[model samples]
Target: MRITTRRRLTRAGMYVLFFAVLAVVILVTDWGRLAQQFFQLDIARDQFPEIITIALKNTILFTLISFVGGLVLGIVFALMKLSSVAPYRWFATAYIELFRGLPALLTIFAMAYMVPIALGFRVPGGQVGAGLIGLILVASAYMAEVIRSGIQAVPKGQAEAARSLGMSPTRTMGWIVLPQGFRIIIPPLTNEFVLLLKDTSLLFIAGSTVLTKELTTFARDGLTNTGNGTTLVMAAMLYLLITIPLTRLVAVLERRLARGR
Candidate 1:
């Protein structure tokens, strides 16, 4: 047989085997039990308005707060990392390495518990505040690297042109280089935002009031109260609802950036 014919036969066999496995799994699954556990309409209904009004709201709010705070601090750190001053560079490097090396869960736990104990004072908004601080720290470390790469990716010719036009170094970076860099980095930044959104689920480690609980906490509480996994399914759907669009947007931005390049 020709090589092409052999390859086609192999491909056909793989496709047939894949569908055969899928059919077997579908035939074996207890659809009724699965539906009762994960898709009970009544159990899901119990979570309705509060899930959207409180849980989803808090998730989005926390993500935005973390992203904004992280973006600001990340810019400062990126600049410090890029600075000619040795102390600034060293401090920035240490911070980035320390946070990036640690698990975000540990960082959040420490911020929520350790710092307050060490300082003999409470973080301003309580546990939520401390968790937010931790999220900002982790997000900043990652964003700083992203921003630094973006800054470095800006063409040296752009800076030279600005300097030739008598623009001060600071002014040139602030006005010209930074803008272009941000444009180049938008897709990555959007991806980071999506990550932060999911990370809000980790905030349950910090503890929360009924009003402050994000989706994971809310769904967990619902699971305890209702004894059905439907709440978890609902939460998963909501997460998909938010993340899928943002991820698609990231893809679109990346494609556009690729085309622009």
Candidate 2:
């Protein structure tokens, strides 16, 4: 009859229903078939050493290369976006808008295949390199906005105070504004890194040799060779192993930043 008693009864009923469904699923599911398809010990074993040495190594390498390249380009565009010169602003806006609006896969495909045919330009590392360049372009567009916002969030007073002390605008921005902006944007930038790490999987569309294969491509190779899905599962687990900690770090940094504010 009481409100608290009714709430408790509702909660109890929900738990019962949840367990009933879970029990039914467990009873009806064929775990042996699932294991054969996705958890075969021999297939998983075959992926060892090479998966770690080649696949995961390539994934991390591509991510670092893309992030560094993207960060440099993003900083340039972010500054251009904030420039008083209209042409600089226009160019920056166009670049950011164009790349961000396009799918990353399409962009990578264009770089890997279309650019070579259209312009006869061979990116330094072949198709893999072209894919990396595409990723950098896409990443720079997103990061430019993040950097620009971070720069704008820095207090105007800070800049004014520096200017009053006879510091040049460039000097003030370099010495004062940028460091503060970077600190403010660290969490978002880290979040971006995690996203980019996962985005390396898209490079598979550009294709790879056994040597150049990153995680997704390597898993596909494993799938083909073994005819079991265990390699896919292994690759997924490795990805989670890398990403989970970074994601948790992002959350921690955000909370700390909020508390500081």
Clashes of each: 0, 0
Give the per-residue Cα lDDT of candidate 1 at 114: 96
Q: Give the TM-score (vs. native) of candidate 1.
A: 0.98
Compose the digit string of candidate 1's lDDT tens values, residues 18-75: 9999999999999999998889998888788999999999999999999999999999
Tell me each candidate's TM-score. Answer: 0.98, 0.95
Candidate 2 segments whose C-alpha is farther than 4 A from its true place: 1-3
Model 2 Cα lDDT, one tens digit per residue, 73-186: 999999999999999999999999999999999999999999999997788999999999999999999999999999999999999999999999999999999999999999
The count of residue-pair clashes in candidate 2 stands at: 0
Which ranges of candidate 1 are over 4 A from the true structure? none
